[model samples]
Target: MSTVGRPPGRGTDEPVGDLVSRASQQISALVREEMRLARAEMTQKGKRFGMGGGLFGGAGLIGFLAAQASAAAVIAALALLLPVWASALITAALLAAVAAAMAAAGRRQVAEAGTPAPQQAIDSVKADVTEIKEATHR
Candidate 1:
């Protein structure tokens, strides 16, 4: 029966230079793959952040319209008992206070989004480096 593959060049023992070159190529490929993975992870997180922010903006727009209608109604009703300007001022002050509170809460939510760094990729790279060092030393 004929052998299936090409005959092996040099039996078992590979040259030091050839071994080092192969190791270098492998390490380079591994680093590239890790970087690609990290980019993908960060991109996913960024999309979520963007989506949340967009939703918040849409909600703010709708809320603004609702508040405007409500404030006008309140001012008109209050104006029946008090001066028009006074009713308007009171309504404005209440709306301003609510806006301030909402702003603070939104800021906290955004801040909680945290850093987008690829922590898993970083740790994996660190472990790979350590393993390479140990192998090289041996």
Candidate 2:
């Protein structure tokens, strides 16, 4: 009973050692592929997190500038109660509002990006394990 055309372990003539070796090799390949997928997924999520963090940094810088402008506005208002100080105050307020909005957006982005875990890869690995177990039982 030549089993050259059939899959491994399916042939009655093949040695048990050969079947085990093939199964181990296939399992190793599957694990490597799953690990690669996990790494890629993590890298993508990391990029999203980096972008969100950058937005937060930008918001902080803007907030600092608004604070400086507010200080200048207060000084102008105290030194000379003119329309210029009022305009400065308005500008500072607008900047501060913009910073707040940016910060909120960044927070939302980070939240939506989710945890750094490779959820898809985990699910795939779990499914693969289930399939292998079922196959072994059969």
Q: Which of the numbered candidates is closest to the native, going by highest TM-score?
A: 1
Write down the worst ten-residue block by lDDT for model 1.
Answer: 2-11
Name the TM-score of candidate 1.
0.51
Residue pairs with backbone atoms closer than 3 Å in model 2 (clashes): none
- lDDT string for model 2 (1-138, tens) is 677988776757679998899999999999999999999999999999999999999999999999788778675765575577666767678778998999999999999999989999999999999999999999
lDDT of 2: 0.88
Q: What's the residue-level lDDT of 81 in candidate 1? A: 93
Positional deviation of residue 6's Cα in model 1 after best superposition, in angstroms: 19
Clashing pairs for predicted structure model 1, backbone only: none
Strongest candidate by lDDT: 1
Please, what are the lDDT tens digits per residue for candidate 1 over residues 1-138? 444573556444678998799899999999999999999999999999999999999999999999789889999999999999999999999989998999999999878976688878999999999999999999
